[model samples]
Target chain A: MNNKLKQLDEQAVQYIAVGAAVLGTGGGGDPHIGKLMALEAIRKYGPVRVLSPEELADDDLVIPLSMIGAPTVMNEKIPSVQQMAMPLDLIEKELGRKVTAIMPIEVGGGNSLVPVLAAAERGIPILDADAMGRAFPESQMVTFYLDGIDCSPITMADERGNGVLMHAIDGIWEERMARAITIQMGGSASICDYPVSGAQAKQSAIPHTLSLAYDIGKTLFESKDSKQNPIEALLEQLHGYALFQGKAVDIRRRTEGGFTKGEAVFEGTDAYRDRMMRLFFQNEFLLATEEGKSLAVTPDLISLLDQDTGMPITTENLKYGARVVAVGFPCDPKWRAPKGLDTVGPQYFGYDVPYVPIEELAGGKGEKL
Target chain B: MNNKLKQLDEQAVQYIAVGAAVLGTGGGGDPHIGKLMALEAIRKYGPVRVLSPEELADDDLVIPLSMIGAPTVMNEKIPSVQQMAMPLDLIEKELGRKVTAIMPIEVGGGNSLVPVLAAAERGIPILDADAMGRAFPESQMVTFYLDGIDCSPITMADERGNGVLMHAIDGIWEERMARAITIQMGGSASICDYPVSGAQAKQSAIPHTLSLAYDIGKTLFESKDSKQNPIEALLEQLHGYALFQGKAVDIRRRTEGGFTKGEAVFEGTDAYRDRMMRLFFQNEFLLATEEGKSLAVTPDLISLLDQDTGMPITTENLKYGARVVAVGFPCDPKWRAPKGLDTVGPQYFGYDVPYVPIEELAGGKGEKL
Candidate 1:
């Protein structure tokens, strides 16, 4: 885990933005504003060092930071670097000490980029790892949470300078209180939480996700100029497969628990003309099915891209009659554990299906209904 | 303003408990739990000194405290002294200073007693004044709020040790965020907020509310022994009038936005037979009308008592077919000011009526429907 540290440059943020969107599973948050903010911070404060988790001092204070609330709100109400840095500063003030490093609580879309601004300003390294290799709607659905890290003494802030500090007995309650605060703070807030020792970060975090996301993002970006299909490039990078290519026929959405929850129906085109695909999501795409059989379920990353443009489509942007391609990739092997399944598997998303690698579910076809 | 102080003994707690209930205007909280807790604290920590608003240094810190969320939740989930004390201690730590005094944010129901324990534990004086002489649903409906005291740096705690510190731009935002937190904290939590200087408190607080509530309670208590009607005693103390005498023929209630909001219809009895009286409320009773004319509107105190027993009936305990007498009393003279009307008048309650004194609305008969 302790390898050469990388610099969080402008070019890297661009790729990570795209990669994070893919892994975001259509939740996280809009990456456009986050990218702009991160770019400005890195430009103003110099590139932040991406430190390997194993390089952490045993006593170092490693805090996880992200935005919590409706992704739609994140898209509309832009957060400031001051807002992003507030929680970090408040945490330091509350503990009456300095935070040694910053890290993403989850790596997905805007979440992957939001913390970069803070890390840049503090002139501290950001851990090259994250709690969730991909975004999760709730804070409790993380390896760190499962490993018994109390995500309390958590601080949050809005662009208008409103702030809240929360401490709960457990991760779930923390998320509950944080969500309410976010909703009240005009729906989107910057959060700094899950304060853990460097030793704990090294043991519990999913390693090299930042580098992995950056690599995936680079591939997607380069493919656009190389005349290679971006979707195919992403599939090759993830060792995933094209699960379906269809026109979204009907989409139903409703907001619940501070999340956009809905399902999309797709009528397959091309070779799979007669096939029907259904996708269910709450903040993130958690389940995928064809006709009636379960094709993929969470812990497996399910992402949808514009059919021609290859840009990752967020849940908030999903619409009827859009031609899109859905892909499924296997998650970090650590997520295959029983407890991991309990944390974010199909059952956690209310789907009654056993975990199966996306490759196994796809069989031989790169494009399956 | 510095006159004399009273010691908060168990006997005073009992009387203040009753007084606060009458002033709670049907919304404060469960008086039983608050009385029990305040008494226990007084018994264990000894009596708290009741300070007059003027009895303070110019810079003495006066913190207002209360229980926030649904009265129903307060009834179901009783809070402990540890929970009550968490916020005050957090505030002290946040401000890096000792709070010199405790004041009720609202002198109604359990709110009047929630601060006593904090005063007892700190061995500080409890102010004999409050933000609201009678209960109002939202925090912004107080004179302190109208006077522009920022409600932030407010802290709340739950029974399970879950706590949150909120800093909002204004009192309304504070209430919005606090309401959401209260809902998540199992619908009720103890909060200590609006830390102001002694000078500010002396200028803005509704003075003598503690003694007013106490006097009302004592009058009711002594009247019970003397075979005098407690309602008449209460009215004498408030300079109010009997708005109506009737059996609660119909009661409609439903929980909304974490508050019990609805109305009750009463069919006038005896000399007022055939006339109907209607009471509208949200947490606290906000208005009363005879047929279509307004008899009372907030910032006036509206209370309902058992027709025979003379015990106050909270909105949570309201039931159909109970014979009750409704009374309306003028609020503090300060509440009749323009700012007060804007804060809690009939329009704030969605009623298309102007504020009118209960005595003026009563026409000729004290017992008129």
Candidate 2:
């Protein structure tokens, strides 16, 4: 690998981690491992430039890449190095084409780094954004779905060297078939699919997501260095607001139909004193409600982080006695569209509240103190 | 409408019901309403021919159509006529292409008839097959997944005239996005997508599933009509075997994230007297086990029907007094492949049982006196 590219790769790890942390908006899982993976890939293969979708040709072949399975499993069974590359390689061979770029399906947790690593190892460029600006539990929650993109010719490779490829007639079949395989493959697999023209990619992807992730991560890190308020810094960076801060006191978890579903009960602390907050989590943090009233639901970002360190917390990693700050960020304007509301709103998560934009829910100040 | 075709449509409802019942294996929900919908559509439009995939050219477009939402809601709310046609029509305009054929993503429950109705109403031909020969709770379970088809570009429409179309970059995203939409659309919606060419459709689809369903359904009806053994006739027709026969003594249910998940405790009645068989349901029958050992899991058609009328009983509709018989049928041989197994076997549902083919599990001998 070129020495300069290697150095740049090292730089990207820090930048990406910072940016990913900020973009995570307090919900993407901690980026430590993701940063390491991307760093290693970049160091080994050479620096992969993060390009805007506009930079690519309209017909440039691109695939959104991510890992599909339980986040809880991901921590335990960390994927083999080749598992991620195998799916992309298979897709390339199957189509008899070369992928021009790699994109992340979502901006949260391990997904933020998956594409960067893929791009570096394959010596391809990374798109500077993701389909979903935040995290979601399933495969079809991206902007591509709203744009009518087909997620076919997807290759899912498990650690056992068993690979299953699904060429479903629609995206839903892809989820069902892939999920079945995922559960069978020991609940984790690497996926690469949703080929699109660069033009479509540009229109559908959240622009500059990588830079944003790096910037956010950097802000958190710098805040610590300068002895500033890290949480406040994050809010200012994303123009986000503090939703709540509390101490988790109870957790009830159960695996149902292969999905991790549970809730974390919290006793208010600091700003949330004398109040209780219950946060529900599946693959991503879904709902944060006080008493019986709704505070926040999915499609918008909801995150839990240590108050002091501003470090991220995975949903599965949450526990009692942990103090966290819940933060909220506005989603892509596209996600706020009627179609978007229909796809990812409070009502969709079984809450009866009408689609209240974060701006309105946050009291129109755009940031709660 | 084709008057000659209308006559066939009228006659086919009974056959379609039988086909739906058999294909549902036991969990397609009461086919009575679905049968009525198909009959009405057939009358209004024309007879829907179930054509084999081989009949089409490589360029012929095929779309897999179905409903996505809580099955219980479908049973109670029932979909308005237009909801079924809206999504496909909207998507057709978006793609600016004529849809050549419609197929079922899953062949069990209400999904089977929704597509037939759409095809008849749209005056399009219906493919004589489906992606999954049986039903699965989620949209992503299908043979198309094995062949690398994606579930994105899915068009979902509610009875309220609202529609959402997604183009996720992956299959799982499709589920996440569509599910939220389904929830927003009032707990249920009509869906039509997974368009494909006839060549790909043929290669990936379970061929002649409609005919198979019709045959099995006919045998069951005839058996019931003649006061013969309806269960025996179904077993013979499907080459399946009885799993257990019992009376439902207890049912625990809760609606979570839009799916009806719970347990049904059945007390053995006939040969299984005094023995307890537990059935699990999520919109469709997912698993059945005795004493904690899973006997059958999803993607392998599992259905529990009324011992008398042979009508299907939905998971949500299970009462404490219903007498039911559970049957296990061999899935399409295609589902037996590694890709197929990975896509729909017991392991896919998080059960640890290595697949014991239903035929073998039944020991080549079905329920008999």
Candidate 3:
């Protein structure tokens, strides 16, 4: 953690990809696809520079760029370099200035690294921060929205060369319009939104998330190298609780309304045999429940990790019969507030469950269910 | 017909509203609402100047502005002046130039006047032409599309102040994206598209359709004042055919896919008593049939008029019990061409009918059923 990253080398991208997947909590698109894209971009364009939010001058314009649509579609349709960079081109043209830095709108398996492709190609430094400390389903579920930042001049591009520039009245409107456009653009699109000033980024964005992802990725990788329990190491590193150890029994996923929506039911195994755990999601896992009790609910993190490799599984990749370890961690404090919970809480996603802190649901930090 | 309209005064707007309704063929939104909006804008500002395509310098930038969505919704959700002008503002900003002239994308009851609201407010001249000689449901059903003109830099605005600027690869893509946005904007939105040079306008645009509308409107009005049969005057003026005189016996309408679509069944009355006629539509009336024989199929024009007044009835305004006269006119020669028919013909609208000229179906000009 002390070794703050300065640039995105191939190794750094590999580590961030794993760490971001864990944070993605079974959404944010597939990590493997993002890692490959980031690697290819880095190999061709050289390493991308990473800057801390504080490093940005107050007047610098920082734009967060990522893919917006159903993760299932994104897994199949890889974006071209032009599609990745077109939003940046449009945003710059709209703002009439060069982007000072690029960053991810959310820290997710795919989104965290999506910006790397653009940053490397543009030769712009990537900010070591993101609007959402962890990935959430909707565009408005970001710290930027929590702080009432204007989500205007949002730009998007599909692989086919169709580009759109939108000025929404607010983040909610941005979500509605952008999602509709994404659906029309073949269910996936690269986007640049919430273009913020460095001052605004420093005030609203979750700081050092890229570095945090790298550290967590390094922990999992190092633990595996040393023949230690990688899942245990990850849980310890994140102060996360093991919600359940189970094998996926059923998963019902459908791509609708521009999102990968569904739920996965797991039959408890090993230490927690003969029980059931259910994880519900709309892109990002929003709630985990067992025996009618809330294990973890959104505004908190819920991740499903492969039991053997300790690698995270996205909602798109989680299949029946996969042995997995479900875990939970406290979300960024900004999300624990009333406004943040109201924006991304379980009820907002149409889940009937109430929002509960991961620690409370787990009966304390690092506890095993 | 000899007088070329140099300006749009209160009287000209009144005439054009009625004339455009005839051209609209029962789509293109309601003329009464358009008349009011155009009148309000003219009274607030001054009479809008009308520029023929020839009057425009070859390099002059002309943009077509109109309302896009289901006429059923447009009749209820009247757009504000800000909404009408926002697309013009956004398009000018996107293109980085001032718009030289404003024209209607389609010469419909509502669309023909929608541009005047912006042209008068911006002090720009209104062009006496439109891309679609008559209104069609989809955005791509324009002469410009048939001419292979690029339809990018399309801009849209909602009453809520949300604005979108899109660069579609083609006219079809523009229709897809713009329609989706219109649906999200509460089923109706003001839009500006097909930014063309005066040279392109002169080549692709249907010239003086506004003047044509004015003449038709004036003929109907004057004939009514002279105690002559207005419908007869209309039929003679346009060299149109009376398909059927009937009373609407059944009307089935639904707003779907960003269009007001359905069919009306009319029981023959007066001269054509004891017969039945069916008219099918998506915004504009595209087909009419009697005993499964095609009376008229699109790329031709079909309209329902009030038998008593000769004022055209919109698809949205047609009632189940109204007495009406269904008429047919040959569409612009451009629409009869292969590309134009392929784009807006009955087959394209899923009618399963071949395109046949109205003159052939009616057996001659000014014929009555």
Candidate 4:
């Protein structure tokens, strides 16, 4: 391995870890585990290049890689390494072709690292981005999906040498089939699917995710020693805005059929005390409401941070009486369109708020609705 | 419409309706509405030829289609006509190829008709087969899945003019994402997914499903008129042996997100009288046991039938004091394979039974294990 390449790999990991933490907002599970996994893969595979969408050839085939199941179960049941490549191998056999690149399905927690590690170990290149700019709970919640991409020739495997391949007519069937197998596989399985042509990959995946992740991660870590406002630093980097400042007052959680669903009630802290906010979660934070009015919905980033440390908190880890700050970041421009709003907007989540641009929702700038 | 086609459609519908009833046994939502939908589609689209597995080309592209959501909601919501084709359209657009054939994902209740109707409407040919000879909840419970296939390029669509295309890293992500989107899309959505190759389809899908459904439906309908035992008639048609006979004494249910999860306590009737059997259901009857020993698990058919009408009872429609016959049918031989069993058999659903072939479990000379 080239020494410079190894150095870049280490530096990239630090950035990804920070960016993943920032992008995770207040949920998407802890980034520590995913960071470690990616780091380990890098150590084993040497340096991985951070490719831009523009770097892809039109005929190149790319697969989106991820871990699907209850995050709670993920903690309890570690995945079998074989399961990780099951989808990739199955698809290759099915297509009778080789995969050219690996892409993360999302840029949050374990997902962000899953593809990176998988690519590194396989000695494959990784598309420096993901489908969703932030995390959402479902497979269909991706830009590629909105762009009408197919997820078939998808494969799922378990550690016990058990595997299932399904060429779903659509993305929904993939979800239905995979969920059953994951539960059977003890609630967590490694997956790599969604073979896409390089053209589709360039058009659909969020662009330049690697560079953004690295920048965000580097800022967060470096700022920690400098006593910088990591959250604010993140906001500037992503051009996001703070949506609320509060303290978690109540949390209710229930795991059903291998999914964790619940809500977090927060009492506003500064400039917002006496007002109440509720954040709902299902593996990922989905909705946020303040004073009984909808504030933010998915497709937009909703990050919850510790008031003091500026550290992010995950949905499962939210505790009562913890001071927190809620921030809203704008998603890719493509997501704000009619189709996008209908998909990840507030209305989609059973809320009535016409999606207010994050710039408008943020305080101090007087960005109007 | 061709007069001959109408008659064939009617006959097919009649057979499918009856087969849906028995195949549903205990938990595939009421197939009536879907039956109507399929009938309408078949009537409009002309007769759908049910091709046997051997008829498919080695290179043909085959896909299975279905609607996934609460049967209760399907009853009221009445899926939009467009939702069925959205995912198919999405996948086709992504693949940049035409699909050669369509197949049923599960040959039970409404789902059985889903692919037939989708094929009729799309004017594509449908294989006379399915992945699971019967129904099981979740997407990963198919023969193809057991064979380590991928479920990606899967598409999910909602009636609210919103559609998501997901190509997740695995089947589990596909399920998780689809479930969340389904809930968000009014607790249910019409889905068309599961794409497979004809060669794999021939090997994976249960063969002769069309004939099986027709025979089962015809037998059940004829038995209603002839005063013969409908359950026995169904068993004979399926070459299936009886598992148990019982009367439901209690049912507990509540809808979470969109799925209806519940339990039914059965007081054995006729030969099974005085012996208690319990069934756990979530959209479909998933597990059953007698005297604390597990009887049937997923990837295998577990059905509850109305003792009088031979009509299948869905978990959402189960009521106390209903006399029902519970039966287990021989699954496709492929499912009996160790790999298939590991992917879907009793053990996959958390049961400890060493996959006693249903033929053996039925203790009969018919349909040898």
Q: Against the true two-chain complex, what DockQ does each candidate achieve?
A: 0.82, 0.04, 0.94, 0.06
> Which candidate leads in lDDT?
3
Give the alpha carbon lDDT tens digit for every residue of A42-96 in model 3: 9999999999988999999999999999998998999878899899999999999
Count steric clashes of candidate 3: 2
Better lDDT candidate (1, 3) = 3
Per prediction, the TM-score for chain B is: 0.95, 0.91, 0.98, 0.88
Candidate 1 stretches greater than 4 Å from native: A1-5, A227-229, A363-369, B1-5, B363-369
Q: Which candidate, 2 or 3, has the higher DockQ?
A: 3
lDDT digits (tens) for residues A1-369 of candidate 4: 011212237667766765775686544445777777777777777877656678789999888878887777776655534567776776676678998888888877667777766677678888876888887766677888788888776776666655555555666666765675577667777775578999999888887666676677777777788866777776667777676788887899887666778888988767887888889878777778877665666777788877766666777677889898887777788788888887777777666667776665554352211
Per-model TM-score, in order, reads 0.95, 0.54, 0.99, 0.58
lDDT of 2 by residue, B264-318 (tens): 8899997888799888777667678899876666656787777886666667667
lDDT of 4 at B234: 73
Regions of candidate 2 where Cα sits further than 4 Å from its true position = A1-369, B1-8, B292-298
- Segments of candidate 4 deviating more than 4 angstroms: A1-8, A180-186, A268-276, A363-369, B1-369
Of the two candidates 1 and 4, the one with more favorable TM-score, higher being better, is 1
lDDT of 1 at A98: 89
Candidate 2 vs candidate 4, DockQ winner: 4
Candidate 2 — what's its lDDT? 0.71
Q: DockQ winner between 1 and 2, please give it.
A: 1
lDDT, model 4, position A279: 91
Q: Which candidate number has the best DockQ?
A: 3
